[model samples]
Target: DARVTQTPRHKVTEMGQEVTMRCQPILGHNTVFWYRQTMMQGLELLAYFRNRAPLDDSGMPKDRFSAEMPDATLATLKIQPSEPRDSAVYFCASGLVRSAQREETQYFGPGTRLLVL
Candidate 1:
């Protein structure tokens, strides 16, 4: 079984900085999701894609957070002008939806760690 891979597992940055994280989904997976974990917001869904088409991103912080798919196996998340509250563990998940309304199992990458000082 293939697995999702992420780079720069840990990052430390100053306030109002830019952070970029990368993820490689499973080879056959067509859906990718980006999420941010925080004690206050809990698990916040940032964005997701189905067949490389963005399905929803209402939970994302529009001013600073952005997600994109440069290819089938690659997904990237960027945070510009990061704040102290932006420090969290960002996770990338990939899966295939067997049905339009239902989602298949998502395999998670180890995640990229970000810290703002």
Candidate 2:
């Protein structure tokens, strides 16, 4: 199965220590991203319909869904710890949204099944 393997393989790490998470894009596709609904940053009017800048997670609840765009070519989504809230990726769609292009129809992928405890 397609997956991402984070380095260190540890539950936690010391401050200043470098950590890396890696994943590969599906064949013939260039985007490998997801959206999460946390109690913090839940859907804010779907402001981010797609994983563009700020990786729109407006579809999320009001917990803590953190998203960032370190640069123009990379998008990152950070999952926060929640007791009663499940941080798993419920809906994952494919396709690209490049500049000056029409938005294409996206197909949903199966749930990541990532249950954080």
Candidate 3:
């Protein structure tokens, strides 16, 4: 079975610290996405990449957060000067984008749980 995998499933850090999370997408998938879940915003797509190239990251704070795909298998999300409001679960999902379809199903990883004190 194809599945997405993430490292450091849980993270706890003091406010203003830097937090980094990594994900390994399922092999053969060409699209990857990063999402943040909070009670106020619910689930928001922070970034997305197609064929290992970043396509959008408008949902994230440009000064404090960054998302990148180092390679075909690896995707990373980093938050510098992390704040209390940034504490939330970050999810990485992967799937194939079909030109014929308007929507495609994505398989999500277990997610990285982060807490900023």
Task: Please report, in order, the local distance difference test score of every candidate based on alpha carbons.
Answer: 0.90, 0.40, 0.94
> What's the TM-score of every candidate structure?
0.93, 0.42, 0.95
True-structure RMSD for candidate 3: 1.0
Which pairs of residues collide in model 3? none
User: What tens digits encode model 1's per-residue C-alpha lDDT throughout 14-95?
Assistant: 9998999999999988899999987888778899998888899998999999999999978999999999999999999998
Query: What is candidate 1's CA lDDT for residue 27?
Result: 92
Candidate closest to the true structure, highest TM-score: 3
What's the C-alpha lDDT at position 85 in model 3? 90
Q: Per-residue lDDT for 1-117 in model 2, tens only?
A: 543322222224333332232222233443445544445765223223233444445554445454444543343444454433443333343456676777665544443333444
Candidate 2, which segments miss by more than 4 Å at Cα?
1-33, 36-52, 90-94, 98-103, 107-111
Q: Candidate 3, residues 1-117: lDDT per residue as tens digits? A: 879999899999999999999999999899999999988989999999999888998898999999989999999999999999999999999999888988889999999999999
C-alpha positional error of residue 58 in candidate 1 after TM-score superposition, expressed in Å: 0.4
